[model samples]
Structures are given as C-alpha cells and as structure tokens.
Target: MATIFQKCKAKGDPCRRSRCGHSWTVRYREPGGRSGSQREKNFPTKREAQDYGIKAENDKREGKYLDPSAGKILVRDYAREWLSRRSIKETTRKNYKNFFENHLIPRLGSKMLCNVMSSDIEKMCQGMCEAGLSRRTVYQSNMVPLRSLFRSAVAEKRISESPVALASLPRLKTKRVDDKSLPGGEAVGAIASAMRGDLAVSVWLMAGCGLRIGEVLALRDTDIVEGAMRLRRQFVRVKRDGVWKAELSPLKAREEGEWRDVPVPSLVEHALRHHLRNHGVGADGYILHAHHGGHVLDSNYRTEFRSAVIKAGFAGESWTAHTLRHFFASSAIAGGLSLLEVSRWLGHATIQITADIYGHLTPDAGARMRSVMDGVLATTNVSRDDS
Candidate 1:
C-alpha cells in the first residue's frame, strides 16, 4: 500500500506562506520488490496523490504497468520503430508510408506519445476535411493510422490505453456501385470486337469472368482448364527504393493463396481458344501475347484498351477494366445466382463486402410484401361510377 504525507517546509525565516503550500506526496515501494520507493510528488491534495499511487500499484499488480517516463518518447521516433517491426504487403506499406509522412508526422510527430488523445484525433479528422481531403482519405489515411499506432503503443506498454478507442470516426464514403452503364450483353461484344489479338481475349475474360485487370494480366497457360480458369495470382506494380516494377502476388484475401475455378463462358472460351491457336504460349509460358515477347505490359494494355473504347463509341474512362468485372457480377446476379454464390465467385473476403458493393442489384422481397399487404388492408372504398 502507498501512503501520502503533507510536506511542510522547514523553519524558514523569510516570506513564509502557510507551510510552503503544504504539498502532498504519495510514496510507495516498487511493486516488484527490486528497488526503493517510487515517489509521486507535487500533488495539491492527499486524495489526489493517494488516487495516483493506488492506480499505479493496481496497474503493476495487473501486469499492465507502464513507466511514466517511457511515454515521453516522441511520436515520430516511436512510429519509425513501429513501422520497422511490421511485415506488410507492398500496397499496404505504401499507404502507411504516405500517411506517416503526410498526415501523422507533420501533425502529431513532435508530441509525446502520452499526449495524443481521442479528441485530438477527431480534430485532425475535421481539420483534414476542412483542408479539402475527401472523407474516405481523411478516415483511411489519417484517423486509421493514429488509432492503429496508439493500439501498438498500448500493447508495447508505452501508454495505458488507446485514445481513439471511443472516438466517433468519419463516415467512409460509398456510392451505389451497381453497374448500370453496361448496355447488357451487346456491350461486351462491342468492346471486345474493337480490340485486336490477345487484347481482345483480355477484354472477354474481364467482362465474362469477373477477373481483375491485374489477375487477367497475370494469367498463365497452366491456369486454363476445360471450361474454367484457376485464379491463383495477380500481377502487381510495387515501388521499392523509389523504383516501380511488376511482381506476381497471390490473390488478395485472408487466405492469400486461395484459388477459385471460375467457369468460363462460351464467348470467353472462344476468345481464349482463338488467341491460343494464333499466338500459342510465349517463351515465358504466357498463353497470350502483345507482339512483344511474352505477356502484354500494363501500360500497353491500357493504351490499347482506351483506343478500343474510343473505336467502340464509348467514353474512354466510363467503361474501365473494372467496369467489365462489375458487368460480369451484375449479369450473374440477373441470371438468378444467389448473393452468397456470387460473393464466392467474385473472390470477396466476406459476403458482407459483396453485399455492400452489389446488394443494390438484388430485388427487395420486403417491398413486394408491403405492396401486397397495402391492397389487402386498404380502408378506403373504391367506387364504380356509372353516370
């Protein structure tokens, strides 16, 4: 147990003021029995000092004790150590570096780790919005890192609690993402016909199979089955030491290596067969080619796709590579596939995610029920007038 004492001044001759203000001091032996007493002084009241000492002792007993001095480390230095200890994906690391350099360090880096509070983070979020950052960017790039670092700090015993634990976060912006611009089945035919060679097959796969552009670019000869394709990997462009290059990475999910056999539609199969017959497999074993050894490069693919869109009489940016994937998803839903089944086919991490993005496409049975009940339960009488 800790004890508090009134530290009265010694018998001084000059300018004495009420026993030198009667400073209260709480003193206790270190809980681990390895050192002398830990003194907490300068408290104005004995109750306050006692409260402090009791909380400290309780924390020590619970194995949650943090040295008060340790939290005095600057946020910037601690953040560096925190980042060094993390092994994250290239894209994730890129975002972390961007947030650390632009948002976190400039604002909170000089402050002590203990001084960062929930309200301060809220203000930062509001300030970022006022400074013209999008709501999603403010929440994702600012508030997220602040909350995350504080969590790490608490786990490392540098601070007692995460400040943002109770903070009301900004709402992440989500527009209704159902693919409406796609003009049904004819849209895919028009777009794919405008492109030449493997570029044509790429379009068919993306539109017909719900394949990501990166995944389409990364496909190999071994991935093709009779009427299905094994989606095992994706081609990603990542920056290291300020240089960017392509890398083959596993599919994105909780289980990174998960591969799904997506059924290839007849049109997609025809395109793939045509390409394989014309180009065969490249020296590097890519099933398609762009007339430049092996698979098509990302920049070249985008360039040709833009030209194709222009030729097909559509705005270059309106129907993107991802738009085709959305087209595939919407078409599948319209063809009577269940939401859960579509989510698995889409390779989403959760059904909730698939629902959030594509749930608008599903018809509302509850609305139909409300309509039927309204007619059956109507109180107003309908008159048959014969004048």
Candidate 2:
C-alpha cells in the first residue's frame, strides 16, 4: 500500500520550506518486494501524490505494477546488456555494435529508457535524413536496431512501452527489377571475358547460378553433388581478437547444417572445370582463393570486378557484382520459372520478397486468362449446338 506525506528535512516535522522542499511524497513498497523495502516519489501536490498512490495500488491488484525506478537505466548501459544477451550471428552483432556506436548512442545514449519519447525517436530519424542518409538506410538499417531495443525493453518490463512503436519512419522507395536495371547476357559475357583467367569463373557462378559474392567465394570442389552445387556456407568477414578476417560462416538465414542445392548450368560447370584445371583448388578444396591460397576477401574480388567492369565498357554504369545475381533472377523470371522457385534459388527469406522485386516481369496474366476464357466459350457453344 502507498501513503502520501509532506516531505520535510526534520523527522515528523510539518511541511515547510526546507532543504528537501515542501512537496508531497508517495512512499510505498514495490508490489513484489520484501517487507521494509520502500520506494518513494515526489509530486508537487498532495492530490497528485494521492492519485499516484491509488494508481499504484490499482496496478498492483491487477498484476500490472511496474517499478518506476527500473526505467532509470541509461540507454547506453541497457544496450550493452541487451547486445550481450542476444543470440545473433557474429557479423550481425558487429553491425549492431557499429550502428549503436555511430548512430544510436550519439543521439539517445544519455537519455533514460523511460524518458525517451516517440518525438525523440522521430527527431533522431529526421536528423538521419537531414544528414543525407538514404530512405532505406534511415528506415531499415537505422531504425530496425533502435526499434528492436525499445521493444525488448518493453518486454523485459524495463519501460512501460516502446517509444518507437509510434515513431515516424522514412518511406522505403522500392525500385522494380527489369531488363533495363539488370544487365543483359552479352553484358555479363563481356564482363566475364574482361576478367582474369583465374577469377573469370566467379562471374558465371553469380550470373548463371544466382550466387552471392560471399557464396561464390565459399564454393568448394567437394561441394559439387550430383550435378548440382550444394551451398553449405559463405565466406564472411568477422572480427576476431580485434582484427577482421575472412572466415567461412554458415549460410545467411539458415541453420548450421542446412544447405541448398542450386543446379549448375553447363556454362557455370564448364567455367568451374576450366578454373580448376588451371588455378587448381586452394586449401580445403575451395575453388576460389586469395593470392596466399586462403579464402578470398571482399576487397580482393571487388577490385578485380571493378577493373573487369571498366574494361567491359561499363565503368560509368551502375552495374555491380551483385548485379549478376539480379541478372540471374531476371533470367529465371523470363524463363517461365515460378516466383517460389526463383526465391529459393536466390536464397531470399520468402517468395514475397522475390515477387516484390520481380513480380512485374511475370507473363501477361490478363492475356492468358482471356485465352483460357475464349477456349471455354468456344467449347460451350459447340456443346449447345449439339444439344
């Protein structure tokens, strides 16, 4: 139970102007705490204190009582604990830490979790936008972590509710995939032809098989199974002992032992065979490796890819190594493959993602429906004449 009393420096003294001030204070033990442990909060008026006392009692009876002091934790401190408690991939954790240090901490670190309001988050998002960050960066990259943190705080009872739940977020502007956005077959061939003999096969693996850059580097000779490439892992950059190194990690969004098999076209297979015959396999049967015969880093491949792109007369073009993946997706959609199949091959989290980007490329559904209806009506007319 809560009780209201006038605050005074002297014990049992009447309310008066003193060092502690003549404000009304509500004193009560937490709903679930042991006896003799009390919590107090000051209010400017006796009625305010009494109202707070009644609300506390009501909350306690309803089992929704929250200790007001628990939310006093600084966001920086709480974020540290929250990061430590999460079970996430190392690369993902690194990204989170970097984002927190660079973006979130600088803006909201000093504020207590309970003190952070939706307007504060909105202001932070607006600041990110004003700094020239892209809409996708502001909404997906920047807001996701903060929103998750506040949601976790609410779940843990550290705060009454998440301030980010109502915060304004940037609108994500999506670009549709089409022949114009994706490179054509000749463009891919030209890029491949311009690459070095040893690394040229990387282009085909991406363009023909829809492999991510990391997946391309992680490919191994032994992973070829029954005329298909079994994607077991990906080469990812991880920070180990204060140094970032290229390491083989599990496939993104997949379990440790889970693997997907992508059929290798004749072009990709021939390229792989030729690459193995000349460059040979690196340590642990990896098809591609750095100069030191270890796993290839992103910089190593990016530099070569850029040089190849320029040599292929696309230096001023926006085409990237990942564009080959888009090229593959575009080709798959054009070849009458279902969105679900394309999504699986592209390793997308869901078919909806594939549809969102490439659904416009689907064959004219209205025309196909019209053709079917025409055939149906013709058959119905013939049956009526026979009757």
lDDT at 162, model 2 = 88
Q: Pick by lDDT: which candidate is best?
A: 2
List CA RMSD, all candidates: 6.0, 5.2
User: Model 2: which residue pairs collide?
Assistant: none
State the lDDT of candidate 2 residue by residue for 169-277, as single tens digits: 5567456776776778898999999998788999999999999999999899999866799998998987788877888788877878788889989888888889999
**Model 1 lowest lDDT segment of ten:** 7-16
Q: Candidate 1 on 1-387: residue-level lDDT in tens?
A: 777766564335443565566777876765566574475656887678889888877977888777777799998899888887776666766788788887778887899999988887788778778888888788765665667888888988888888778577856655557465664677678878898665788888888889887788888878988888898888778776787767777787734677877888898888888888877776767765657666666766778887888888877447677788888888787676888988887888898878877878886578878999888979766777778
> Model 2 Cα displacement at 341 (Å)?
2.2
What is residue 123's positional error in candidate 2, in angstroms?
Answer: 1.1
Error of 1 at 246 (Å): 1.6
